[model samples]
Each structure stands twice: as structure tokens, then as C-alpha cells.
Target: MPPSPSTRSQAAAPPRRDRGDACPGALRLHQAADGHLARIRLPAGDLTVRQATALADAADLLGDGHLSLTSRGNAELRGLAEDCGARLATLLRDAGLLPSERHERIRNILASPLAGLDRHTPSDVRRWARELDALLCASESATALSGRFLFVLDDGRGDVAALGGDVSLLAESAGDGAGPAGSALLRVGDDPAALRIAGPDAPRAALTAAEAFLTAAAASGSGAWRVRELPDGHGLTARDVAGALRSAGIEAAYVAEPPAPATRTSPPYADSAAPGIVEGPDGDRALSVLAPLGRLTVAQWRLLTAIADADGSGALRLTPWRGIVLPGLPAATAPDRLAELSAAGLITDPASPWHRLGACTGRPGCAKSRTDVRADATAAVATGTTVPAEAPTGSPPSGVPVSPVGVPVSPAGVPVYWSGCERRCGHPHGTWVDVLATAEGYRVALVDPDTAPTAAPAPARTAAPPAP
Candidate 1:
């Protein structure tokens, strides 16, 4: 069994120092081999339909026609020209996407993408997430947080919780009048146990906790920006975090142990029959959609805009899993609209190829990559390989796909991911098959959950492979 939340402990290590983090943003673009790379922070992954359309337009006008999704639930516009930052910033600002220039990069927040929409979730994690973003943006010192710093808000489920956040607030059931129906448990590093605070105070408490972390990191003289990198002696404690919350006027308590949130393997998708009615706990429903491989062509992007125009009432939630959910649609029009989206290759089914496959900007877009991993993965998929399916409660068995093309890939199963090099960007969580590029060609490895890690020998191929 996975370690319970209460039993988890922080690592003991001295703090390490760093000058500062240089993660780029819309305002501060990073020059890549292809062009400029600009990451747009979508706190709680919320974007208006207009905002989504603007991003698509930006990609077409200032960067590549394609958009890349970050593991942090942010969007990346690559292949941008040298002079596109100011233009891009202005465009996003007008669209209500760029709220704070200084805080844009540091505005890293992940929440339950399907919260309020998913049947099993208790509350809309988006509300808490937005409140937290507002708090962070309003803070004068929050600019100190590195662009890479992350915050996760899970609604009593272990989805985003598994992504390994720097500061996390997992929601739990609460008592009436004690607080909202849910409480927030704060976690630092990978520790299981966390400090609990009122649901209403969760945003404020999280801000205070982050401030405390920054102060500790500075005091230790370890220049560490991330909680986990803090040296042994400089590690944070639940008691210390509780004290910080109290100082900030937010009530908090250290729980000896908290229940480990359950993990949900299924990705969010629209209910074809119900449409806007998102399934929640006890047969409830919500509006949800997937961004294929988290990349959208201009045409596909337009389709999303059309859906938003027809179904979404001016709001769309960008999920941390690189998808979108539109809440409050008319039940009558939703099914037909969802059908249109499904016809366009958006995965509304729990099991779909787009949900299972993820790849980085390899080859032409990235100078460091040895091959176009995305193209390669697409080629592999076309070969009719039977993508892996989600394993049962027991340990997963090992094997490669039997057929390569037209097979549904399971997000929770050991699916295949291609990398330009050893740095496998956008790699999926849980079990997976790794195909790494080398000077001698691709090296295939099957990651096993039950035994020591080992690599599978590459299959012999003809001098020339089939066209992708």
C-alpha cells in the first residue's frame, strides 16, 4: 500500500543555494533553438473562451502554429520570433490572461481540473485555486518564488497530488460550521502528513506557508528555491508551518496523520448524453474536454472556441492534466456539441490515444533533441501496436505493445513515450515504456514496477523504416 498521508516525513538535508531560477514566461521569453519559448501561467487552469482563442491566435501569429503543454499545467508557445515578447504580452494582457507581469512566472498553481465537474469530487478546487492565485499575486514578496515553484490543490483525490508539488493543499471532508464541507491539508516536500486548515482559510494559509518556506530557505543561506532541495538541517517542519499560519491570522493544526487521498485513474471527458451535466459524487455530471496531446492546431483550436461559444458560458477550466472543462452548459445542446468535438479527435472517452500519449518538442523545435520524438511516437502508434491498458490492483506485467496503430492507450497503464534524449520531457506518471534516442538509434526500455529496472533490447529493423 502507498504510504498514508500522516506517516510521510520530510527529508533531512542541509539547504543548497542558487543564484535564482530562470524559468521563462510570456513577458520573459527564453530563446530556444527553434525560436523564443514563452510559458503562459494558467493558475487553476482557468481560461475564458476568448482567452483560449487568443492563445491560438498568438501561436499562429507570434510562434509556431502548435502549442505545448507543460507538466505544471501551463501552456508553452514555442518557435516564437525574437521580437514577439512585447506583442505576445500585450495580446495576452488584453485577453485577461496576463494579470501580473512580475508575478506571471511565479503564478504556478495546479488544482483538481475536473473538480466540481467530476462525480467523485466534493467541491470546486478552482475556487480555492483562484483565491490562492489572487493572494500570491497580491503579495509583495511572492515574487521571490522561483518560476519553477509549484502549488497543487487537490479535491480529496490523488491526481495532481502525485505530480510532486513544492507546496500542496489536499482537500478533505469537513464538519458543518467547523468550516466548509472540505478542509485543506498543507504539505511541504513529499511528506505524507500535512497541516490542516479551514477550507475558507486554505488560500491564505497556503500563502503564509509559502512565505515561511521562502524565509527558511533564505535564513539557511542555502539559496534553495525549492523545499526539497533544502539541506538536511534546513528542512521545514509541520510545527513551524502551523506557527506561520497563526502569525498570518489563519488557524491551522498539525495532524499526526491524515487519510491518504484516493487516486482516480480515469481522465475527465464530456458525458455524450448529458452534455453540460457533469457527473459528480452520486451520479452528478459536468462538461469536460481534452486537448489532444496537449497540442492544438489552429483549426482544432477554432473548434474549441466554437464549443466554448456554443456550450461554455464564457468560462473554461484548464485542467492540470492538459485538458479543459466547461461548466454550466445547457443540457439540451451539450450532447450534439460534444459529438462534434469527439469527431475532431478530442478524446472524450476515458480510454483514448490522445490521453495516453505525450511527447516533447523534439528535433526541429529543440536543438538538444536527437529525433522528433512526437513524430516518432506518431509513427509507432500508426503501426497498429496494442497500447497497454490500465493494470489491476496487483503489480503490472511487463511487455511491449502487440499492435502499434489505432490502439487505445491507457493513461494509468504502462504506455510508450518517446524522448529525444535522456531528459524525457512530458513523461507520464505511473507505469510507462521509455524509448530514448542515442547515437546508435533508439533505446527501448520497459519500466517495471515489481523488480529492478532493466532495458529491453532494441528490435532489429530494416535499413529503411516506413514513412511516418
Candidate 2:
């Protein structure tokens, strides 16, 4: 079984702060192993067609022309030149991408990628997301939060909640008008559901809750940034959070264990059989596009923008899984547009090569990686050795079948990930087979499905003879 929320919350050891977190941003780039890395924050993972194209252009102009999607629903440009940081910042700013330099890193918010469309969801979570973002940017103290600090506004589903955010506001039924017209359960970590606030006030309540955590961190003087890192006795409590909300003139009621909600995964984009039937106001139909291995080229980015302009609504939604959802497109034009994307090697089918596969910025992008893992994995796939379903089952004990080079493919479509080293930065969220690169070649194992394992040990690639 997956670890209880409390157990998961306690897993992170108190972070030892040597200095402030220097996580790269569009304005502040990081000198990565491959080159300079710039991370552009996408609040609520909303991207305009033009903005998406701009990111692709930035990648091609300043970096290696490859874009990487982060777990936080942001984008990363690797292999950037040290000198291009300023120019890149200017380009992003002109595109209305970087609104605040001070609040850039603190804009970590993940909401239901399909909140507005899902019948079960409340009104668009985007509104609350935008409001919370504006509030966070305006607060001077929010700068103190670490770049990794996260906030999730789930549409009552446990999807984003499963990500283990620092602050989470889950929408819930208003309980027959007991409190207000629309209210949600406010929770922290795996703790008992602590409060209930008006649905409209959820954003403010979330911010207040964050402030309470910051206040506790300040009192602890541990220099801790995340809520989980607070010492046992110094942790923030529901009562204290309620007090803080009251002080801010927000009504909040304490509740016990709150009900866990369901979360939505990336809907399959390959199903474009009836496109124009579900049309949007602009006479465009929804087009779901996937980025193979979650990486896209500048040319491909431009092509997507053109497709969206010609065939879809002007807006784009970037899923946490690194896929794009173009809503409001004309149903008649969707099939052809999807074919264009597929011809360009984008994953348009659920059974395509990109489905369960993910890779980090290996080779030239990350200095810590021992091998160009992505290249090697691609080669393995091209040779027809790595079958999509061959990924192993529950954490295969050490010395299990390694790669497509020798292992027989399984019938079930299990997930697999290729990691440069043990860090395994971009491993898939749920059940997956782990293939880690070693001095020898690649170590393979079936990871335990119930518990989300961080990284599994891979045998040295040198252990086995090279495949002929």
C-alpha cells in the first residue's frame, strides 16, 4: 500500500540550509552540468499559444532547442549559454511570461489540469489559482519560501492531492448549506481535515494557511521552508491556522479527517474520432497533443502554435504529465491537425512510443548524469528491443531482467523509466520499471507499485557482456 499521508509527510529530513535555494528561473538561470538551465514558471500550467511558441523559440535560440517539462508543470531550457540569460529574460518578459522577478520562484501552484471541464469540479479552479498567485506575488515575505515549496488547488479530486503538496485546498460539497453556499475542506499534509472555508474564500484561506506555516517556521528558527520540515513540537496545527484566519477576518471552521478526493490524469489525445461535435465558442475543437518523452523542439513548438491558431482555440493547457491540451477547436479540423502532429512524431495515440516513457535532461544537460540516457533509450526503442509493455512488475529484486537487449517483453503495458544515475529525477508517478545507468551499462528492476519508491539500485552496466 502507499505510505500514509503522515508517513509521506515525515519522509523529508529537515533541509539543511547552506544558503537560499538557487532553483533556476527565467530571470535566474542555473549553471547545470550540460550548460546553463532556465526554468520558466507557468502558474496553473496555463500557456497561451504564443507563449508556448516563445518557449520553444527560447530553447532554440538560447539553448539546445529542446524543451523539458518539469513535475511542477513548468518548462526547462537546457544547454543555455551563460551570456544569453539577460536576453532570454527580455524575450520572456516581452511575451508577458515573467510578470514578477521577485515572485518568480514562489509561483509554485498546481491545480486540476481539467478542473473547468470535469463535471465533478467546482467552477474553474483557475480563478482561485490566479488570485492566490497574485496574492503570493504581492506579499513580501513569500520570497522566503523555497523554490520547491508547492501549493495545490484540487477540484475535489485527489489527483493533485496525491502529489503531496505543502499546502492543499480540496473542493468538497458544502454539506447541505451547513456553512456557506460553496465551501471546501482545507487540509495540510496527511493531517486531519482542519478547516472549512467558503468556496469563494478558499484562495484566501489557503494563503492564510501558508502564512501560518511560515510563522511556525520563523518561530522554529530552523530556516525551514516546507511545512513537513518543521520539528515535531514546532509544527503548525489546525487551531493555530484557524486563529490566523480569524485574525485575517476570514471565517474558518475546524474539521476532523477530511474526505480524500479523486484526481484526473491526462486524458488520451489519440481519440480524435469525433472532433467538431464538441466545439468551443471560437469554432475550434479540443486537440490533445503529447510531447514524446516529454521533450519538444523549437520547430515543433511553432508548428503546435500554428495548429492551435488554425484549428484550435487560442489557449493551451500544459498537463503535469508534460502533454498539451488545446481546447475549443473545430471538430472537423482536429483529425487532420492530429495527423500533422503525429507525422511530426508527437504521440497522438495512446499506444505510441511516448506513452509510459519519461527521461531527464541527460547528456550535456545534466553534469551528474553518467551517460546520455535519453539517447541510449531512444536507440533501444528504435531497435525494437524495448517493448512498451515489457516494463517489469513490483520492484523486481536486484539482478532482475535488465533492458530490451536481453529481457523478454511482457504483455501488459507496464511503465519504464531510464535514469542517468540514482537520482532518477523524472521517474513516472505510479507503477513503473526502473532502468538506471551504471558504469557498466543499465540496471533494471520492477519497482514496487503500492509504495512510491524514490530510486532503485541498478546493477553496473559493466556487469553483463555488451549486446552484439
Instruction: Write the residue-wise lDDT of candidate 1 on 29-65 in tens digits.
Output: 8777788888889997777888988999999998879
What's each prediction's TM-score? 0.83, 0.83
List, residue by residue over 94-129, the lDDT tens digit for candidate 2: 888878889898798988765654344554567889
How many residue pairs clash in each candidate at the backbone level? 33, 22
Go through the candidates in order and give each one's C-alpha lDDT.
0.67, 0.68
What is the alpha-carbon lDDT for the whole of candidate 2?
Answer: 0.68
Worst 10 residues of 1 by lDDT: 459-468
Off by over 4 Å in 1: 1-17, 174-180, 264-287, 386-412, 446-468
